[model samples]
Target: MTAETHGDRQLAVRLGELLGPRHPVAAAAVVTPEGTHVASRGTDADADADFDFEIGSVSKAVTGLLYADALTRGEITTDTRLGELLPLGDAPVARVTLRALSTHRSGLPRLPKSAQPWRRTITLWRNGTNPYGETLAQLLLQTRDVPLGTPRSRYSNLGYELLGHALARAATTTYSELVQQRIATPLELDCFYVPVTADELRPTALHGRSRRGRPRQPWTGEGLGPAGGIRASITSMARFTAAILDGSAPGTAALDPVAPVGGGARIGAAWITVQVKGRPITWHNGGTGGFRSWLGLDRNTGTGAVLLSATAASVDRQGFALLAEHSLSTGNSDSNSNSNSNSNSNSNSNRR
Candidate 1:
């Protein structure tokens, strides 16, 4: 058998072991100097590279890229305020800086305060409805009442949502359109996109399930587009990962560590960088009502890995382990590698 084919088989076995038998559907890919290898585990006929999965907050990482690219284009500056672009009259949040928002130090709450968050949560648990279905105007109206706290390093979906829209406003376009023009089209990631509503989802979009196997409605909305509304196929993710590793992706600067985000980790825009097995691995994980995703890159070794699951199960550790293994297999690192246990525990805490 060819060496590459045998390697692919072994990788597939390892992926299966990581996912276990209960996961209904998942797709994984490992990018190395040799090339990219993809694998899947599911019985569904539509489970393949082209099947779209809600990437959740990994969309923030994409926004991080846009943020950096915008900086390069001089469309905005780190000191830019939200009120400068978005029409948030005198809300305290309007004074927050783009840099602070991107690093999650804007003191914005994890989510906008709903008059009945408990009711919303219950509704989500019972019907799998999209709670973040607010439009841009609705989001702005909601932001008008949001009170900001002391700037600190806290993961805030609200911050990214506002940051993305402000950037879009700077470009004189919508957040979805800005992403299409800057990131997807440039990288040729045809299946990567943000759908502002459930009805906008493509027919090939896979239906996700809850942790206990209940089917879920797709999570899509104009307000969530920059934070958790992105959906992409495994094939598009592979291309995106490869582009990030090769510095060909727009806003590649977003991967650089800029501020410490506690636990000995650092943040750059929305991406998190942590030392795993003595190597600095940059990554971001996402979770929604029905889906989970993780993408990690070992830039030092030019290797990366992505994991997408149609169930609400955390896949951060598997992604880290895959990148570590791929790095070792490519003779890019020492053999004393171990998966970063902290990643699985901390990365998915901010579920969308």
Candidate 2:
């Protein structure tokens, strides 16, 4: 068998093994100098590469890119306060700086307070409905009464929600439009999008399931788009990872580590850099009520991996192992094999 075919088969097998006995639908991809390798586990109707999955907080990584791009365009600065762009009035959140927001040091809670988050959480657990379906205006109103805690390196979905909208406002556009015009269109990620409501989801969007196999509602809302509302197909994720690795993605500077985030890791905007297998791996993981996802990249090796599962389960370890294995296995392949494989993969990706 051809080496490329053999490699593809091996990757598929490994993905299946890693997934093992759980998760009704999942997709994975690895990018190397020899190009992208993709695999999925599901029935014929749902296994296509174009099937969309909610990416959850990985949306923050995209928002991070936008934040850095805004900085470059002179539309915002690290010190820019929320009040400068968003209508937060004299609220404590309005005084938070953009840099602090990006790095999760803005002292905002995990979810908007105006949404009656505690009750929503109970409703989500009982009814499998979305807990973060607040509108942008609702989110802003919610922030008005939120008391800020001491700023530290804390993860906050609310921080990103505001940061993204503030960045969009700085550019004189809405957050969804900013994402479309800047990242998705420029990268040709046809299925990459932020849905403001459940009805906006494409037909191919997969229904995620809870751990006990209960169907969960799609997490979509105007206020949540920057935090956990974005969705994309596996192919789009693969292409996005490739762009990030090659430094061709806009706002690549967002991946540079700027502050420590404990556990010997550093934060770069929304991305996290941690030591894994003795190499610096920049990554971000996400989970909604129904889905879980992980994306990791070793820029030094020019290798990256992404895992998307329709069930709410951890995939971080599997993602790291996949990337490490791919990096090691292809580290010394001959130039001709690498060229041929990369050509094939790139051609197929472009055709999609």
lDDT top scorer: 1
Q: lDDT values of the candidates?
A: 0.84, 0.80
- lDDT per residue, candidate 1, 256-297, as tens digits? 989988888888989889888677889998998889999998
lDDT of the structure predicted as candidate 1: 0.84
lDDT of 2: 0.80
TM-score to native of every candidate shown: 0.93, 0.90
Off by over 4 Å in 2: 1-8, 46-49, 330-352
* Local error of candidate 2 at residue 330 (angstroms): 4.1
CA shift of 348, model 1, Å: 6.5
Winning model by TM-score? 1
Provide the lowest-lDDT 10-residue window in model 2: 343-352
